[model samples]
Target: MFGTDTDARNAQQPDKPIICEVIDPTGTPLNVRATPNGEEIVTTLSNGRQVIPYKVSYDEKNRHWILIGDSLHSWGWVYGSYVSCLSA
Candidate 1:
Protein backbone atom coordinates (compact mmCIF):
# COMPACT_ATOMS: atom_id res chain seq x y z
CA MET A 1 0.00 0.00 0.00
CA PHE A 2 2.95 2.28 0.51
CA GLY A 3 5.44 1.30 -2.16
CA THR A 4 5.50 -0.34 -5.56
CA ASP A 5 6.46 -4.01 -5.97
CA THR A 6 10.02 -3.11 -6.84
CA ASP A 7 10.12 -0.55 -4.03
CA ALA A 8 8.97 -3.10 -1.53
CA ARG A 9 11.62 -5.53 -2.65
CA ASN A 10 14.24 -2.84 -2.65
CA ALA A 11 13.31 -1.81 0.88
CA GLN A 12 14.17 -5.31 2.01
CA GLN A 13 17.60 -4.80 0.59
CA PRO A 14 19.61 -2.35 2.63
CA ASP A 15 21.35 0.26 0.53
CA LYS A 16 23.40 1.81 3.31
CA PRO A 17 24.99 0.31 6.37
CA ILE A 18 22.46 0.22 9.20
CA ILE A 19 21.78 -1.66 12.37
CA CYS A 20 18.84 -3.83 13.33
CA GLU A 21 17.99 -5.01 16.79
CA VAL A 22 17.40 -8.58 17.88
CA ILE A 23 13.84 -9.36 18.88
CA ASP A 24 13.35 -12.96 19.81
CA PRO A 25 9.76 -13.90 20.56
CA THR A 26 11.04 -16.66 22.80
CA GLY A 27 12.45 -14.05 25.21
CA THR A 28 15.96 -15.37 24.91
CA PRO A 29 19.04 -14.95 22.78
CA LEU A 30 18.49 -15.54 19.10
CA ASN A 31 20.60 -17.93 17.11
CA VAL A 32 22.92 -16.55 14.45
CA ARG A 33 23.36 -19.30 11.93
CA ALA A 34 26.00 -20.04 9.34
CA THR A 35 23.16 -20.20 6.88
CA PRO A 36 19.47 -19.37 6.82
CA ASN A 37 18.38 -22.78 8.04
CA GLY A 38 18.23 -23.90 11.67
CA GLU A 39 20.92 -26.55 11.25
CA GLU A 40 24.10 -24.58 11.84
CA ILE A 41 24.05 -21.96 14.58
CA VAL A 42 27.22 -19.90 14.72
CA THR A 43 26.43 -17.64 17.65
CA THR A 44 23.72 -16.37 19.95
CA LEU A 45 22.68 -12.74 20.17
CA SER A 46 20.80 -11.34 23.12
CA ASN A 47 17.62 -9.44 22.67
CA GLY A 48 18.07 -5.72 21.91
CA ARG A 49 21.56 -6.32 20.55
CA GLN A 50 22.36 -4.60 17.30
CA VAL A 51 23.72 -6.20 14.12
CA ILE A 52 25.06 -4.72 10.93
CA PRO A 53 24.18 -6.68 7.81
CA TYR A 54 26.17 -6.53 4.62
CA LYS A 55 23.10 -7.44 2.63
CA VAL A 56 19.96 -9.49 2.69
CA SER A 57 19.71 -13.00 1.33
CA TYR A 58 16.73 -15.26 0.66
CA ASP A 59 16.19 -18.91 1.26
CA GLU A 60 14.68 -21.39 -1.20
CA LYS A 61 11.20 -20.47 0.03
CA ASN A 62 11.97 -16.76 -0.13
CA ARG A 63 12.46 -16.19 3.56
CA HIS A 64 14.66 -13.17 4.34
CA TRP A 65 18.11 -13.75 5.74
CA ILE A 66 20.40 -10.98 6.94
CA LEU A 67 24.07 -11.35 6.14
CA ILE A 68 25.47 -10.18 9.46
CA GLY A 69 28.98 -8.71 9.48
CA ASP A 70 30.86 -9.43 6.27
CA SER A 71 32.15 -12.48 4.45
CA LEU A 72 35.78 -11.67 5.31
CA HIS A 73 34.89 -10.51 8.81
CA SER A 74 33.09 -12.01 11.81
CA TRP A 75 29.96 -12.79 9.90
CA GLY A 76 26.99 -15.11 10.09
CA TRP A 77 23.45 -15.41 8.81
CA VAL A 78 20.33 -14.66 10.80
CA TYR A 79 16.69 -14.97 9.91
CA GLY A 80 15.12 -11.56 9.38
CA SER A 81 12.07 -12.55 11.38
CA TYR A 82 14.00 -12.20 14.61
CA VAL A 83 15.29 -8.74 13.77
CA SER A 84 13.61 -5.34 13.62
CA CYS A 85 15.01 -2.56 11.50
CA LEU A 86 15.39 0.59 13.57
CA SER A 87 16.37 2.96 10.79
CA ALA A 88 17.49 3.15 7.15
Candidate 2:
Protein backbone atom coordinates (compact mmCIF):
# COMPACT_ATOMS: atom_id res chain seq x y z
CA MET A 1 0.00 0.00 0.00
CA PHE A 2 1.09 3.58 -0.57
CA GLY A 3 1.41 6.11 2.26
CA THR A 4 -0.02 9.61 2.42
CA ASP A 5 1.90 12.62 3.80
CA THR A 6 0.12 14.85 6.31
CA ASP A 7 1.20 17.96 8.24
CA ALA A 8 -0.76 16.75 11.28
CA ARG A 9 2.40 15.36 12.85
CA ASN A 10 4.00 18.80 12.70
CA ALA A 11 1.05 20.38 14.45
CA GLN A 12 1.63 21.44 18.04
CA GLN A 13 -0.21 19.93 20.98
CA PRO A 14 -2.59 22.68 22.08
CA ASP A 15 -3.63 20.67 25.09
CA LYS A 16 -0.25 21.14 26.77
CA PRO A 17 1.34 23.96 24.88
CA ILE A 18 4.48 25.48 26.39
CA ILE A 19 2.78 28.25 28.32
CA CYS A 20 2.58 29.40 31.93
CA GLU A 21 0.75 32.29 33.56
CA VAL A 22 2.08 34.54 36.27
CA ILE A 23 0.34 33.55 39.46
CA ASP A 24 2.32 35.92 41.60
CA PRO A 25 1.59 39.63 41.93
CA THR A 26 4.49 40.25 39.57
CA GLY A 27 5.28 38.15 36.49
CA THR A 28 8.67 39.45 35.51
CA PRO A 29 11.89 37.99 36.90
CA LEU A 30 15.58 38.64 36.60
CA ASN A 31 15.75 34.83 36.87
CA VAL A 32 13.39 32.02 37.75
CA ARG A 33 13.91 28.89 39.80
CA ALA A 34 13.91 25.50 38.06
CA THR A 35 12.35 22.77 40.14
CA PRO A 36 10.15 19.73 39.56
CA ASN A 37 7.30 22.06 40.41
CA GLY A 38 9.00 24.49 38.05
CA GLU A 39 8.40 27.28 40.52
CA GLU A 40 8.32 25.76 43.95
CA ILE A 41 9.80 27.98 46.64
CA VAL A 42 9.35 30.57 43.95
CA THR A 43 10.11 34.21 44.16
CA THR A 44 6.32 34.72 44.14
CA LEU A 45 7.13 37.44 41.68
CA SER A 46 7.90 39.76 44.58
CA ASN A 47 11.52 39.08 43.67
CA GLY A 48 10.46 39.38 40.02
CA ARG A 49 10.39 35.79 38.74
CA GLN A 50 8.50 33.87 36.10
CA VAL A 51 7.58 30.17 35.65
CA ILE A 52 5.76 27.69 33.47
CA PRO A 53 3.29 25.38 35.12
CA TYR A 54 3.84 21.97 33.54
CA LYS A 55 1.42 20.19 35.83
CA VAL A 56 -1.47 21.08 38.18
CA SER A 57 -3.66 19.16 40.57
CA TYR A 58 -6.59 19.63 42.95
CA ASP A 59 -7.23 18.39 46.48
CA GLU A 60 -10.51 17.85 48.33
CA LYS A 61 -9.14 18.38 51.83
CA ASN A 62 -7.66 21.62 50.62
CA ARG A 63 -10.55 22.72 48.47
CA HIS A 64 -9.41 26.31 48.43
CA TRP A 65 -5.77 25.36 47.88
CA ILE A 66 -3.96 24.07 44.79
CA LEU A 67 -1.55 21.15 44.81
CA ILE A 68 1.53 22.20 42.88
CA GLY A 69 4.83 20.41 42.23
CA ASP A 70 5.84 16.95 41.07
CA SER A 71 8.21 16.13 43.92
CA LEU A 72 7.55 15.32 47.53
CA HIS A 73 7.70 18.33 49.90
CA SER A 74 7.98 20.38 46.75
CA TRP A 75 4.21 20.54 46.48
CA GLY A 76 2.42 23.67 47.61
CA TRP A 77 -1.17 24.19 48.61
CA VAL A 78 -1.60 27.70 47.39
CA TYR A 79 -4.88 29.51 47.15
CA GLY A 80 -6.76 28.80 43.93
CA SER A 81 -7.35 32.52 43.59
CA TYR A 82 -3.60 33.04 43.14
CA VAL A 83 -3.34 31.17 39.83
CA SER A 84 -4.72 31.82 36.39
CA CYS A 85 -4.90 29.75 33.21
CA LEU A 86 -1.73 30.33 31.21
CA SER A 87 -2.68 31.83 27.87
CA ALA A 88 -1.34 30.80 24.48
Candidate 3:
Protein backbone atom coordinates (compact mmCIF):
# COMPACT_ATOMS: atom_id res chain seq x y z
CA MET A 1 0.00 0.00 0.00
CA PHE A 2 3.01 2.30 0.40
CA GLY A 3 3.80 2.02 -3.29
CA THR A 4 2.20 1.77 -6.68
CA ASP A 5 1.91 -1.04 -9.25
CA THR A 6 5.32 -0.08 -10.59
CA ASP A 7 6.74 -1.19 -7.23
CA ALA A 8 4.95 -4.55 -7.08
CA ARG A 9 5.81 -5.35 -10.72
CA ASN A 10 9.52 -4.80 -10.18
CA ALA A 11 11.90 -6.62 -7.89
CA GLN A 12 10.99 -5.45 -4.41
CA GLN A 13 13.63 -3.72 -2.33
CA PRO A 14 12.58 -4.67 1.15
CA ASP A 15 15.61 -3.12 2.84
CA LYS A 16 14.47 0.48 2.38
CA PRO A 17 11.32 0.18 4.44
CA ILE A 18 13.05 -1.59 7.29
CA ILE A 19 15.39 1.31 7.98
CA CYS A 20 14.42 4.31 10.12
CA GLU A 21 16.53 7.43 10.67
CA VAL A 22 16.25 8.97 14.15
CA ILE A 23 17.27 12.25 15.77
CA ASP A 24 17.21 12.35 19.54
CA PRO A 25 16.04 15.41 21.46
CA THR A 26 18.64 18.13 21.49
CA GLY A 27 20.51 18.69 24.81
CA THR A 28 19.21 15.37 26.03
CA PRO A 29 21.17 12.19 25.80
CA LEU A 30 19.78 8.76 25.09
CA ASN A 31 20.82 5.37 26.42
CA VAL A 32 21.78 2.41 24.28
CA ARG A 33 21.26 -0.71 26.32
CA ALA A 34 21.98 -4.39 25.85
CA THR A 35 18.39 -5.06 26.80
CA PRO A 36 15.19 -3.11 26.17
CA ASN A 37 14.44 -2.96 29.86
CA GLY A 38 17.17 -0.30 30.33
CA GLU A 39 19.79 -2.61 31.91
CA GLU A 40 23.37 -3.19 30.79
CA ILE A 41 23.62 0.13 29.09
CA VAL A 42 26.21 -0.10 26.35
CA THR A 43 26.77 3.53 25.38
CA THR A 44 25.55 6.98 26.23
CA LEU A 45 24.02 8.77 23.32
CA SER A 46 25.35 12.28 23.68
CA ASN A 47 23.40 15.40 22.95
CA GLY A 48 22.38 15.47 19.31
CA ARG A 49 22.66 11.75 18.82
CA GLN A 50 21.78 11.89 15.18
CA VAL A 51 21.52 8.39 13.79
CA ILE A 52 19.15 5.75 12.61
CA PRO A 53 17.44 3.95 15.51
CA TYR A 54 16.37 0.35 15.22
CA LYS A 55 13.88 -1.22 17.59
CA VAL A 56 12.99 -4.90 17.53
CA SER A 57 14.25 -5.35 14.00
CA TYR A 58 11.05 -4.41 12.20
CA ASP A 59 8.91 -7.04 13.79
CA GLU A 60 11.79 -9.47 14.21
CA LYS A 61 10.73 -12.30 16.47
CA ASN A 62 14.27 -13.00 17.60
CA ARG A 63 15.64 -9.54 18.62
CA HIS A 64 16.09 -5.87 17.76
CA TRP A 65 18.77 -3.85 15.97
CA ILE A 66 20.10 -0.27 15.67
CA LEU A 67 22.73 1.42 13.47
CA ILE A 68 25.14 3.70 15.31
CA GLY A 69 27.65 5.58 13.18
CA ASP A 70 27.66 2.85 10.55
CA SER A 71 27.60 0.18 13.22
CA LEU A 72 24.66 -2.19 13.23
CA HIS A 73 23.19 -2.77 16.70
CA SER A 74 20.06 -4.14 18.32
CA TRP A 75 17.34 -2.79 20.66
CA GLY A 76 13.90 -3.45 22.07
CA TRP A 77 10.50 -2.84 20.51
CA VAL A 78 9.45 0.83 20.46
CA TYR A 79 6.10 2.10 19.34
CA GLY A 80 5.91 4.61 16.53
CA SER A 81 4.14 7.28 18.59
CA TYR A 82 6.84 7.07 21.22
CA VAL A 83 9.47 8.28 18.75
CA SER A 84 9.71 11.80 17.41
CA CYS A 85 11.90 13.08 14.58
CA LEU A 86 13.65 16.23 15.76
CA SER A 87 14.52 19.01 13.35
CA ALA A 88 18.10 19.94 12.80
Candidate 4:
Protein backbone atom coordinates (compact mmCIF):
# COMPACT_ATOMS: atom_id res chain seq x y z
CA MET A 1 0.00 0.00 0.00
CA PHE A 2 2.92 2.31 0.61
CA GLY A 3 5.40 3.61 -1.95
CA THR A 4 2.76 4.35 -4.52
CA ASP A 5 3.51 6.88 -7.24
CA THR A 6 0.49 9.02 -6.43
CA ASP A 7 1.40 8.93 -2.77
CA ALA A 8 4.98 9.98 -3.40
CA ARG A 9 3.85 12.73 -5.71
CA ASN A 10 1.34 13.95 -3.18
CA ALA A 11 3.84 13.97 -0.35
CA GLN A 12 5.45 17.26 0.59
CA GLN A 13 8.03 17.79 -2.13
CA PRO A 14 10.57 20.57 -2.45
CA ASP A 15 10.17 23.47 -4.84
CA LYS A 16 12.59 21.61 -7.05
CA PRO A 17 14.30 18.25 -6.99
CA ILE A 18 17.10 18.56 -4.42
CA ILE A 19 20.12 16.34 -4.78
CA CYS A 20 22.36 15.92 -1.75
CA GLU A 21 25.73 14.43 -0.99
CA VAL A 22 26.31 12.41 2.13
CA ILE A 23 28.89 14.18 4.30
CA ASP A 24 29.48 11.81 7.13
CA PRO A 25 32.95 12.68 8.44
CA THR A 26 33.66 9.28 9.92
CA GLY A 27 33.89 7.86 6.38
CA THR A 28 31.33 5.27 7.32
CA PRO A 29 28.01 4.94 5.60
CA LEU A 30 25.13 7.10 6.85
CA ASN A 31 22.10 5.44 8.34
CA VAL A 32 18.89 5.90 6.45
CA ARG A 33 16.12 5.90 8.98
CA ALA A 34 12.63 4.51 8.58
CA THR A 35 11.48 7.52 10.54
CA PRO A 36 13.08 10.83 11.40
CA ASN A 37 14.98 9.44 14.33
CA GLY A 38 18.24 7.63 15.04
CA GLU A 39 16.63 4.54 16.52
CA GLU A 40 15.03 3.27 13.34
CA ILE A 41 17.82 2.68 10.88
CA VAL A 42 16.54 1.17 7.68
CA THR A 43 19.67 0.99 5.57
CA THR A 44 23.08 2.58 5.14
CA LEU A 45 23.77 5.24 2.60
CA SER A 46 27.40 5.71 1.73
CA ASN A 47 29.24 8.94 2.28
CA GLY A 48 29.77 11.09 -0.83
CA ARG A 49 26.79 9.43 -2.44
CA GLN A 50 23.83 11.42 -3.70
CA VAL A 51 20.11 11.19 -2.91
CA ILE A 52 17.10 13.14 -3.96
CA PRO A 53 15.33 14.96 -1.16
CA TYR A 54 11.55 14.87 -1.06
CA LYS A 55 10.53 16.49 2.19
CA VAL A 56 12.08 18.33 5.12
CA SER A 57 11.05 18.16 8.74
CA TYR A 58 12.24 19.78 11.95
CA ASP A 59 12.18 17.39 14.82
CA GLU A 60 11.40 18.18 18.46
CA LYS A 61 15.14 18.55 19.04
CA ASN A 62 15.22 21.13 16.27
CA ARG A 63 17.22 18.92 13.95
CA HIS A 64 16.07 18.94 10.34
CA TRP A 65 15.67 15.61 8.60
CA ILE A 66 15.35 15.16 4.90
CA LEU A 67 13.22 12.53 3.24
CA ILE A 68 15.32 11.09 0.43
CA GLY A 69 15.13 8.41 -2.24
CA ASP A 70 15.07 7.83 -5.97
CA SER A 71 12.14 7.20 -8.27
CA LEU A 72 12.85 3.49 -8.21
CA HIS A 73 12.83 3.25 -4.40
CA SER A 74 10.73 4.21 -1.44
CA TRP A 75 11.81 7.27 0.53
CA GLY A 76 13.78 7.18 3.75
CA TRP A 77 14.71 9.85 6.22
CA VAL A 78 18.28 11.07 6.71
CA TYR A 79 19.61 13.57 9.18
CA GLY A 80 20.22 16.91 7.54
CA SER A 81 23.62 17.40 9.16
CA TYR A 82 25.11 14.59 7.11
CA VAL A 83 23.71 15.81 3.83
CA SER A 84 24.73 18.73 1.64
CA CYS A 85 22.18 19.76 -0.96
CA LEU A 86 23.81 20.16 -4.34
CA SER A 87 22.72 22.16 -7.35
CA ALA A 88 20.51 20.30 -9.78
* Model 1 lDDT, residue 78, Cα: 79
CA lDDT, candidate 4, residue 9? 38
Per-residue error (Å), model 1, residue 8: 8.1
Any runs in candidate 3 off by more than 4 Å, and if so which? 1-14, 17-27, 53-88
lDDT by residue for model 3 (1-88), tens: 1133332222124354332344344445556555553356666655433454432332234323332333464443232222332222
Residue-level lDDT of model 1, residues 11-33, one tens digit each, is 35545445677888898788888
Model 4 C-alpha lDDT per residue in residues 19-86, reported as the tens digit of each score: 67788877889999888885888889888788877776667886677788986775689877777774
Best by lDDT: 4
* TM-scores vs. true structure, each candidate: 0.73, 0.33, 0.38, 0.75
Can you list the residue pairs that collide in candidate 4? Answer: none
In candidate 2, what are the lDDT values of residues 1-88, reduced to their tens digit? Answer: 0011111211123464333233554444322333322345553333312233444333444223333333234333333334443344
Query: Which scores better on lDDT, 1 or 3?
Result: 1
10 residues in a row with least lDDT, candidate 3: 1-10
- Which residue segments of model 1 deviate by more than 4 Å? 1-15, 70-74
Determine which window of 10 residues in candidate 1 has minimal summed lDDT: 1-10
Q: Which model is ahead, 1 or 4, in terms of TM-score? A: 4
lDDT, candidate 2, residue 31?
24
Count of clashes, each model? 0, 1, 2, 0
Model 2 misplacement above 4 A:
1-14, 23-43, 62-78
Q: Model 2 clash pairs?
A: 29-48
